[model samples]
Target: MNSFFARKYVIQGIFISVAILIIARLFYLQIIDDSYLLSANNNVLRKVIVYPARGVILDRNGEVLVQNEPVYDLIVTPREAKDIDTLLLCNLINIDTVGFRKRMDKARAQSPYRASIFEKQLSSRTYAKLQEHLYKFRGFYVQNRTVRSYPDSMAAQFLGYILEVNDRDIERSKGFYKAGDYIGASGVESSYEELLRGNRGVKNLMVDALNRPKGIFSEGKYDTLAVSGDGLVSSLDKDLQILAERLMKNKIGSVVAIEPSSGEILSFVSSPSYDPNLMVGRERGNNYMKLLNDPHKPMFDRPIQASYPPGSVFKVVAALTAQQAGVIDQHSTFMCPGYYSYGGGRARMRCTHVHGTTSLVHSIEGSCNTYYGHVYARMIDSRGMSGPKAYDLWREGIMKFGIGQKLGIDLPGEKPGLIPTSDFYTKRYGSTKWRSGYNISLSIGQGEMGITPLQMANIMAIVANRGFYYRPHLIKGIGEKKIVKEEFTEKIYAGVDTKYYESVIEGMSRVVNQPGGTGYSVRINGIEMCGKTGTVQNPHGENHAVFFAFAPRENPKIAIAVFVENAGYGGTWAGPIASMLVEKHLKDTITIPKYIQDRIFNANLLPAVKVAAPKAKDAAKVAANTTAGLPKSRIPSTLRINADFSPRVNEDNARVNPLIEFNSQVYE
Candidate 1:
């Protein structure tokens, strides 16, 4: 009886302890933790996301290039919506009844209790109309958002475009972005996305049974304000960009102009470009499809994407490299008897004229292929070096001018371009069989060499700075502080000594200033412009006209490169365009004759557009059409050269100025 009583007391003690613990836990949750209460009142609470305004983009002069315009998204909670007039709601949001049902089904699929976007990017008029009758709808509300707006409607490729975030974009953002969020897809929009897209905030509100917002939940304790994104001051010059676009209007090519001292890109133009505004609003997808289908390829960003042979413009790099290697000097003479003979006279590279004894400067001015051929031969074979070793060293020297590699510009889709390595030659032509003569076309900037307009322009900047250059960039400042990144400010040397640039500069100067120089026709009267003209050979069609220049000679301000596709000579098209840009930037006016401006403005070099779309089987044929018969590795896959388009020059104007004449004998 005593043992039984002791066991009973122990069991009673355990029961009493458990009851007390349970009561204490309930008391703590009810009195201290309000989170449980919030969960219990979930039916009455609502969470709303507040989106911040996207950053504005300004030109270097503080002119607004891109800004935000407000729009609305119609959101709905399917469970809360009951016995509503579906047709009226659809009419208010400018959607059909069928569309409304599909959206409702989609919302229910997402979460019946949670709100989702029913319709997005509502215009101001629609939002105003919907706001008056929104009380009639139980579960629908409007959420404010902003879309990008380009006021000037220019720089389609540079400014880029934004689209709704995909699954990949959301995953990459690490839960920061969800469905229905917009993200930058290309160009500066993509490059500075984080700074341009500001922080999003949230607000908790109390709602009635009708789903109408009553007031802030817990008296605004859970509310957070949205912070607008920081504005960006771009390096682009609005006027210059506009002029470049105008000049490139009917042509097919690209232009890249940079400020030599700061490496700020002033003007970037890719011809056959569409207005940036087309990439905005509800019509964006349709417009994008049209642009994508257009044969001219307005969507391709040529400045950083299209890689063409540098042509005679590359001779400047050859000259510097030859000087550094001690193969040539200011007075070094090469005999050019109309052509350069190599492979024991089996191969001949023709020249424009028979320059009997051409000096280093004269070689550049005249663009004598024979002079460079001899100089390159000596540089490759002399000094008791093997051809492969010498060639690799030559490539290294050329790459220092920002060639054969991406200059790390503040843009997307930059290609490093093609500069074949000695290993590449070895793979193609066996180890010991390939000699300097096998790839001598490299001396004149052709055959396996490719360069984008951006890199070419940067090369001019290197020369303008006398063998040093800052990395080319598009942004000048970020936020109100106007902070420039350290990478953009750092000076990168081109690996050539300063002394080597004088003779090259003199040759370039003569190319513009002297009568016999190739670029003499396009020389500005007052400004001492140093420029080189290049007529790049194209196997598919007419040669590409190319020019690179820096102006005022001393303390140069602007450096530029221009390429005109299917145009016969650089002096006729590319040189004039570059000179005009220089004049406009420095003098802020066009002092050149009206004929010069008219020639570029009126010229139509665009290829004929195909009326019928290519079939599925013919797609490969269409893609290969531009670079037919050329090796895929040699050129950019997207590079489109018009095989049949002939450049039509005004014969009347050509006769008026003998310097503007396109001479068949003159080939670079």
Candidate 2:
């Protein structure tokens, strides 16, 4: 009887121990660990993301260039979705029933309980119509978002375009970006993306069984407010940009203009361009493919990406280098007997005219090839320095002018262009065999030297500032504080001393003002413009017309570079266009006759042949092929212009008659 009593007491103790353990586990789950509680709350409460509006881009004059337009996205939680009118939902969102099912399956695959996008970028009209019937469809809600809108529909490549993020972009952003988030792909949009995308917020929303938002959960205590992106002020001048684009309407090349003192880009144009609006909305993919397949390559950024031989314009560099090396001075003279004979007289480079006893100023005014040839030879061999050492020094001086290197412009994909080193020549022609005469074509800005229009324009700015320049930039200010970067304000010297620029500037002045000047026909009457003209050789077709200048000569306001492909003489096509740009910028009026303006406007220089459009799957491959493996001096020959046009002159105007003659010559 005592043993039975002891067993009963032990069993009672065991039961008590088991009860205590159960109570402790219940306490831990209910109070210490909140995961289950949070999961339960998620069933009734929906977490919605509030997207902030992207920043608006404005011109220097406060004119809007890019702004945001409201759009909506349809969100769905597949777990809450039940039997509903799928057809009605499809009709409201402008999608078919099959598409709705596909989207629903995708959402379920992602996560049945988590919210996912169903239909993206819905128009306001569709959202308005869908909102009234939203209560009828379970597990679906509308979220507000924004897309970019361009008012002027210009600067397609300058402003760039935005597209939804892919796997790589999402990976790059870490956990910040989802599959449907938009990212800037190029231009100012890309460079300023971090400041322009703004901050996203979240709200805990209470919803009914129908998935309609009833009210803010917990009286909005847990919600965060979205902050809109900071506004950007660009350096672009709206009127100047418009005029530049209009002047280059039918041509195939680029134009870049900058304010000399500040190095702020005023006008940027790449011709054969399309409307920026085509890159927005739901049709972006289709339009992008079409632009990729275009024969003229309107999408290519010619100002920064396309590299070409600088032609005779490079003589400016040769002259500057020779002067800096103490090999030549302003009064230095070289005899030109119509050609420069080099390589022991086996080869010759021809000049346009037999200019006898050409002085420094006269050589530039006449675009004399023989004079620069002799100067370059003296610079390389006559100096005590060896050929390779002198060549390196020459390249170093040219690079100081921002050639053959990326100028660090705020745009993406800027080509550094090509400036071969002494090592490159050593590999090509062996060490001792190659000499100054072997690469004499470089004296006139040819033979393996490549320069982009942006770099060319920067050279003009350096000359205008009398040897120093601020880095060329597009953004004038950022945010409401109007903060400008310090790098853009710092002065960069071009290695050449200030004193040397005067003689070169005087020669450039003569190129526009003097009677025998190559650019005289295109000069403005009241403005004291200094300029240079280049007829760049092309292996595929007609020579490229090139010109660069700074206006009013002293305290120059605007410096510009214009390149027209297959346009023959530089003074004829490029000089006139650049003069018009300068006139419009400084005077706000074009003083040139109406017939001269009409000549540029009416010219059709685009290629006549149409290339076969690549299939969507092969678009990228074809685009790569189109831009690859072409000579640097010209665009792809398949897209070469067939129409050869010359400026039509009015017999009454004697000043304009000089354009009829080809003043600049090219030879090997």
Candidate 3:
């Protein structure tokens, strides 16, 4: 009986202790933890973010290339919006009732109490209409925003388009950005994003007892003021850029001009370009699609990304290397037949025509393939050096000129074209196994070597300077700080004997000044230019015309490169273009004789004959060197092509109505 009584007392005491602990826990929750109450009250408060305006971009002269324009986005909160005549409201905004309903449904699904954009970037007329009738649509409001604008109105590919930040970008950028923030996507805009994207500002307003905004809290003492981004002053020249674009109309190629001594790129032209204004808003993706799908591939940065064999342009390099190696001199001569014979067990290299015995200068003047072929074989195969063995000396010399490798250029998408090394060949064919005969084409700037037009211009700069060149760059400064290239600013010898370049320069000068020079037909009168021309042969039907030159020979100013596709004979097509560009740069006008200009303007250099592609062991993967077919010598000239045909013109795509149908005026 005593044990039962003790058990009853212990059970009663335990029950009382449990009751007391439960009451204390409730007290702690009610007094100390306020998450539930705070969250409940938050339903009445809202936070809104005010985005900062992005920075502007300008040319070297402080001309605006990119800037912002104000616009309005129509927003709606379904639950707060009331007593609406849906049809009248839709008519007022020029949106259909069905469209309005669809948007409302979407907003309701997201959150009836939260605001969402219904229609973005409304026109001024529509915005004005909305402002006058805002009370009629109670829940609808307008948010101010900015869009991109371009003035002088041409687009360079590097000034990439901008768009609203997507979920993916917001998530990726994480803490530093939000979905509505603007970001630079390409060109200088991208490269200097951090500098160009200024700091954002915030404002906190105090509310009255009725939840109405009264005034800024302490005059926004805690708010951060937005700072405008520093402007990008580019190296581009306005007049030259416009002229290059106008001249390149309907052509599929590129032109690059630079100060030979400084390597400051003055004009960069890529044809079939679009306006940057098209990339500033919601329709950017659609506009980009149109340009991207264009058969001309205007979006591609050909100067930086497209690699072609230097063709006979590589001959200048070979000639310089040969002279530097002491294997030859300025007066060195080689006999030319219609074809060049390789020393031992090799096929004879076919030429367009026999150029006769020519010195190094004459070789460049006449662009004698036989001369370059012989020099290449002798230089590489001299002393019984294997083919790959000869390539090493050649490769090393080529590398010094910034070929077969990245020149450490400032632009994006630059390619380091391939220059075969002995190790590379040894791995492919075996040590002591590959002979000069294995790749005799390399001597003439053919075979496995490839280079871009930008590199081609850079090479001309080196040759013009007689052994040194600056690194090619586009931006002059980001505000006050100049984008100086530390590497090319200081002269580098390029590891070549200066005397060797003089001989090549002599040949190039003759090519322009002498009647026998391949470039003489298009040569400018006042300016003495030393340059090489290449008829880069194409796997496609017509050959690509190409030229590299620098003017005012004794003291050079401009170094240039031009490529015109499907245009026969570099001297005929590319030479004239290069000459015209040179004249424009030197004199700011076309100095071409009326007859020469007519010849150029009237020449139709598209395929006159279709040569069958030879089937030989995967020619598809052959080295990317461009094939250049010289115009036949005067003695046995092919019927010269004259420009009688005009490029196909599409009137709708032309700029007759940029004012009435500017993207802002249309796709909106």
Expressed as tens digits, the lDDT of each residue in 1-668 for candidate 1 is 99999999999999999989988889889997655664446446887888989899999999999999999989887876778988888888778988888988999999987789888889899999989888788778788899999999999889999999999999999998989998889999999999999999998988765557778889889899889888999999999999999999989999999999999999999998998888877678899999999888999999999999898878899999888888888889989998787777765666778888899888888888889888878878775778888888888999988888999999999999999999987777666455667787787787788999999999999999998999999999999999999999999998889999999999899999998788888889899999999877666667788999999899999999999998878988999899889999999988767898899999998855545545767766776776677785775423433333454433111110111122112254
Each candidate: RMSD:
9.6, 8.9, 13.2
lDDT by residue (129-161, candidate 2, tens digit) is 999999897778888899999999898889998
Q: How many residue pairs clash in all the candidates, one count each?
A: 0, 0, 17
Per-prediction TM-score: 0.85, 0.86, 0.78
TM-score of 3: 0.78
Error of 1 at 552 (Å): 1.1
Better of 1 and 3 by lDDT: 1
